[model samples]
Target: MTMQSLGDVVGNLVDGIGNERYWRGGKIAEPGVYAGVDIERYHHDPDLFDGFSISSSGLRALLRRPAEYWWSSPYNPSSQEPESKPALDFGKAAHMLLLGEDGFAGQYSLRPATYTDSKGDEKPWNGNATSCKDWLAQQAKAGRTVITETDIAHIRHMADALSRKEAIRLGILNGKIERSIFHKDRDIWLKSRPDVIPISSGDFVDLKTAASVDDETLSRAIFAHGYHVQAGLLRVIVREILGPDAFTSFTFVFVEKAPPYDVRVMQLKDADIDIGERQARQGLKLLRECLRRQEWPGYDGFDQHISYIEMPSWAKTRIDNELNAEAA
Candidate 1:
């Protein structure tokens, strides 16, 4: 018998999920603003519309890598489970705590620093130990996600920092949280879930966790993480669902995860939204064509022609400076 490599094992897992269609039960979600949809259901249920629907994140993937988008989409046959990251996990926990969700104790548990062994001896909790593994399994069976005690404390501090900001506090207090919105535009199904929507005020707010909220870093992050795309998509969805006159402003509330837990609030300008919306529309067009042909292409995309390479601007500048020094 041939032993399967780790890559093969992972590949098989992905194939299994894809074949199962992520077990969404094939129910079609109607296009509208959903107030109480579970976050899990919103993420996993790809048949939310009559056909495959694209979220802001999906659009970003489609724009950057069509093949990646195909595999990451729960509606596609090649879809795979997204890999979890520590930072993402931490951010999720923070969101749950800060978003006015009740019963935090029911959803999350902190791993005890020490556990009593069967022999009645106290030992530090070793994750690799069989007893520790069993303990974690029990937590899972109890329907509680396990997190570090330190993380719990950090989340509390982050929340406190946000509460100190007058605009953030008022915005959240006056808004609905985690609303799922689905709309059809130009024969394409699109979805968005804004973190907070102050309908009365016509202001929308999104929460983001970051390492730094400095101007330069946040500006880079906005483009790098396709936040502009997200903003653009939300604008379209909100306008379609509510009305052109309903949306007055869109803001992002960013909080640091570490010490001091600084907070910053920035609202997108009209020009920024325009740019983001244009990019989103372009991505949707590309996605429509790929879906129709059932052909998701990677960066190379069946192109076999040899391509010439150009030196990077920084490298070229360095070489020129060196040549000038030699002449001097």
Candidate 2:
């Protein structure tokens, strides 16, 4: 679940309610912004490994086509031709589970998680023939343990956190609130619909869950990318919602949730805002290159306009073997 606010969750657990909201969802056209790392890896086309032909103009043209234009929207891809590119499949994969909580269409395709045996042997748990109960029936038949309803609820909660907005709040605020004032009338939006309005904290809050937390490195980057770019966008929205004082300051909450939660509070200044705007323009240049090519977003983006990120020269370096081979 994505968190929007940072309230004390340690001892004041009873009095203070953490109004958590995730900013990663809703109506954003930017790919990978809302994508789960696992889902992004799963949906990416592995066959487009040849790299780009004209990586500059081709990519630029592709980005421009969709600023407010039409691209092919696939309806049903499994029945389509091989070269047609399973876009319908991609869209369906992204959104299918969002509409239903108990949906298990992806189950048949998913490989079982690795587990240990009773005798203390580790093995893979997939491609088996088993008939157990409903959820654990297959696992039991494969010499695996039966899963509890509580455990299943956890997995469902996790997937919803990744895919649906409804899961966002549930995953973030679970085992905490028994009755929430945020929802009256028996959780109408919470119960009836499969989604909720994308969360808004009325301010920017950036929380980083990592192994070892560093507040300094985090603030610099957040001030550079997350706060500055989003602040320009947020200023307009916040102004409309709560008037002009909303733009008076930029608020950032960075929380490192490991064994203990260490929270840091910081703000972005006018200079940092300038850096973010410059970076956004650099990003848009890459987007423009993508537009020119009609190429879809994929893992092999390094071949194109990603800002020559590590292109600066070092003091001393080994020869470029690939470049040498080409010359030879």
Candidate 3:
């Protein structure tokens, strides 16, 4: 046989060694910016990219409940689909109306208030009737989410409220919407899908639907939902894909879902973002270890050690004050 050239031999070796080797069981084989990915595919497709990856929401799950994260991860052999929530569906519909090109009309259909009966008489669609059920099933089969007319009206009002905000309007006008970005951070792969990325200005905006945008309530919600951690992770991914100085700012645009739809815009403080980054790094490290050993521990952790629970400081102070009043 004729001797093969060095280049040919290398090519053969590379072909023999597939991208699977890079996956290392659960890590992504390739990482970079992925643009124009459909939101549904990006969120629902387990094998969208080359291999397993984690988004900001996944990172939040990993931090809060690794077991849940593992159960939901596509990389897991016995992973289960998450149950749908009406609130989440509403949010998605709002996002479609606000961010999607085709709008909610393409992905959602409004359930008629009434349906024609066998006698051609109009009857209220109570959603329990056989015809209504069949109609809903048909909508599902047609890959459309069924929403009430009120939902459509509320979403439209929320969109209208957001439109009046000059800053939000400008950002949406200048930015790319629903772009997915993937980057390998050391051992594990990270993924991010920002709501809006104004490439030239390097400003990013995340849209949120909330019950209240009042300072106190919104502040608590931000911490409770770990929005800061999401902000941190997104900033890192944005900077990694675009140069070091590419990320200029991140803003959260919150809109109330009820009538009179109020809107509020908040920019995260650098200090809070720094804290979020640290927390994100911690979560990533924990994730790497968990994946390496295939051990997913819940909030209680794997230890058999006892956990101590304590009363709140406010409660303790209240009790002390009552005792002093009784003694006096």
Best by lDDT: 1
Each candidate: what lDDT?
Answer: 0.77, 0.34, 0.75
* Count of clashes, each model: 1, 21, 0
Best-first order by TM-score: 1, 3, 2
Tens digits of per-residue lDDT, candidate 1, 221-283, equal: 988988988988888887676655445567888999998899988887878888999999999
Q: Which ten residues in a row have the lowest lDDT in candidate 2?
A: 185-194
Residue-level lDDT tens digits of model 3 in 215-326: 9998998799999999899888866766455565678888999977989888888888888999999999888788787799988866658899999999999999999999
Q: What is the TM-score of each candidate against the true structure?
A: 0.82, 0.33, 0.81
Question: In model 3, which runs have C-alpha deviations exceeding 4 angstroms?
Answer: 1-30, 102-106, 118-120, 140-143, 309-328
Global CA lDDT of candidate 2, please?
0.34
Please give the TM-score that candidate 3 achieves against the real structure. 0.81
lDDT by residue (7-35, candidate 2, tens digit) is 32221222222333222323212111111
Per-candidate RMSD, Å: 12.9, 15.0, 9.8
Question: Which sequence of candidate numbers ranks them by lDDT, best first?
Answer: 1, 3, 2
Backbone clashes (count) for model 3: 0
